[model samples]
Target: MTLELRCGDVVTGCEGVVSGNTEEEVLTAAAAHAAEAHDLTTIDPATERALVAAIHPV
Candidate 1:
């Protein structure tokens, strides 16, 4: 999967095999990586929201 960063760079990946294809799982995992590895606490709220929404798809 391709995920666009706040800086407009697209990162194509996932660290490990996706156990379950769920939106919350994907977002939480990605967000955790952003915080832990990149030291990015605050990301674009709009983008984040969009990503989460896309994953969840009400």
Candidate 2:
């Protein structure tokens, strides 16, 4: 199963969606997206928790 995460779930107004074979992959992609598109250079504990919670099997 693939793991997917909707960027909108964590960042309001973002419609990006990222998926991967593993949670780590998706998180890495999401981090890149965050940095490139959202200007988020760091994932704090709360944001990291939210990102993990938002990820689901697709």
Candidate 3:
């Protein structure tokens, strides 16, 4: 039960992807990558929801 999320699908002008065995793991890694690579310090509630919604089984 792998899960994946693509930043390009949710964010414009970005091409990042994260995957994990669980949604929480993927989201955690994605957030860290976003902070370091995309300069995002925090993900707003709506954006978090959107990210979750964008997650797909892979």
Per-model TM-score, in order, reads 0.44, 0.95, 0.91
Model 1: per-residue Cα lDDT at residue 7: 20
Off by over 4 Å in 3: none
How does candidate 1 fare on TM-score?
Answer: 0.44
Better of 1 and 3 by lDDT: 3
Candidate 2, residues 1-54: lDDT per residue as tens digits? 999999999899999999999999999999999999989999998999999999
lDDT of 3 at 35: 97
* Runs in model 1 lying further than 4 Å from the true structure: 1-20, 49-58
What TM-score quantifies how close candidate 3 is to the native fold? 0.91
Candidates, ranked, lDDT: 2, 3, 1
Q: lDDT of all the models against the reference?
A: 0.49, 0.95, 0.90
Clashes of each: 0, 0, 0
lDDT by residue (tens digit), candidate 1, 1-58: 4332232232345333221256566666657666776676765887577555444222
| Residue 27 CA displacement from its true place in model 2, Å | 0.5
